[model samples]
Each structure stands twice: as structure tokens, then as C-alpha cells.
Target: MSERTRIPPLSPFEEQAGFTRALRAGNRIVVSGNVGVEEDGSVSPDAGKQADRCFALIREYVEQLGGRMDDVVRVRMFVTDIADADAVTAAFSRALGHVRPTGTLVAIAALYHPSWKVEIEAEAIVGDE
Candidate 1:
């Protein structure tokens, strides 16, 4: 069996909800949906900034589970408004343009939090390069 590892979440709700921030099984890593909220519970009002934070957190978790951004093969982004798509795309480009992973962006009605404009998730394969 492939060894499995769980990367602890930065959010308290994750522990209470019985989910991890990320999981690694052998060479593959999957990061859960991440919001733009900070460690202190502060969130940016700007959609771009929030998306940026989500990507940052995703990168961090991927690395923690022994993967690089370049190994990320797929990403899914959920935005509360279609108008924010441009800003979120800009942020995604800034974060993963070099990796150029396959991605999907869809406008959703809302997130768990009212202030969250975007949520992101990632999947990566270690040493895929």
C-alpha cells in the first residue's frame, strides 16, 4: 500500500469537520479547498488578494506534502461572482503561470463565509517533472 500523509490545516474548522488541509498518498498530493482567510482570521476584501492568499496556502500545503508547484497537474477555482473572474485569473496566472496546470474556474453562489470571494484546490504529483 502507498503510504499516506495528512497535512494539518490552518483552519480550526478543518479539525472539527474531520478533514485535512492536504493529503499525500505516495507521490500524489491533493490540497483541499482553501479560502483567502489569514491565520488571524482576517480576509481581504479584494477578490484578487483573496485568490492570491488561497494560492499561497495551496502552494504551502503542496510543498509540505513533498510536491512542488510545477508538479501541480490540476486546479479548480470557485468564485462567488463572474465579475471577479478576471481578477482571480490574474492571481492564478501570477501564481501558477509557469506551471500552467489544467484549471477550471466557475462562479458559485456563495462560500462558507460571506467575505470569501474565491476558493481554490490543487492536485500535484511529486517528481512529475
Candidate 2:
């Protein structure tokens, strides 16, 4: 069995909630739901920009766990407002459209934070590159 590796929690709630930001085991990498909270803990009011932040963090965590964004096989996106779908989709295209990873986007009621409009999660296989 391959050893498990983890990317330490980026959010304070992760440790308290007993979850990791990302994990790698064998050839697979899984990233937890990522919100648009900036480095300073402030979130953008723009949905597209928020989506952009989520993808950026996902890419960073994926790479840190020994996988490239190109290796990502699937992605799941959640948005609190259906109206924000277009903006979120545009951001996703900009971030990972070239990789052509399968994706699912769904409209939800609300996020853990009322201000957060979107959240994203990703899965990658190291050898996919």
C-alpha cells in the first residue's frame, strides 16, 4: 500500500472539523471544498472572482500533493445562487478548460459562510499527466 500524504489545513476550521485541505495516497489526490477566502481572509463580492480564487487554491493544493492541474480528472462546484452560474462557469473555463476535466456544478441554498457564493472540490491522478 502506498503511504498517505497530506497538505496541511489552509483554513482554521479544517483542523477543528477534522479534515484536510488535500490528501495524496498512491497516485490519487483529493482536495476538499475550497472557498474564495483570500490570504487575508476576505472574500470577493464578485462571483467570478470568487470562483477564480477557489480554482487557484485547488491548483496550488493539487501541485503541492504531487499532481498537476492537468492531472485533475474531476471537479465539483457548488454555488449558492443560480444566477452566479455563468460567472462561475467562465472562471472554471479560464482555470481548467484546457485540461477538459469532467465537472459538475450545482446550485445550493447557502454555504457555511453567508457571504461565500461558491465552493469547489477537485480530484486528480498523478499519472494522468
Winning candidate number (lDDT) = 2
Scanning candidate 1 in windows of ten residues, the lowest lDDT window is: 7-16
Candidate 1 ranges beyond 4 A from true positions: none
Report the error of model 1 at residue 51, Å: 0.5
Off by over 4 Å in 2: none
Q: How many pairs collide in each candidate, listed in order?
A: 0, 0
What TM-score goes with each of the models?
A: 0.94, 0.95
RMSD per model, one decimal:
1.2, 1.2
lDDT of 2: 0.92
Model 2 agreement with the true structure over 15-123: per-residue lDDT tens digits: 7888888999999999988899999989999999999999999999999988899999999999999999999999999989999999999999999889899999999
**lDDT (0 to 1) per candidate:** 0.92, 0.92
Cα error of candidate 2 at position 87, Å: 0.5
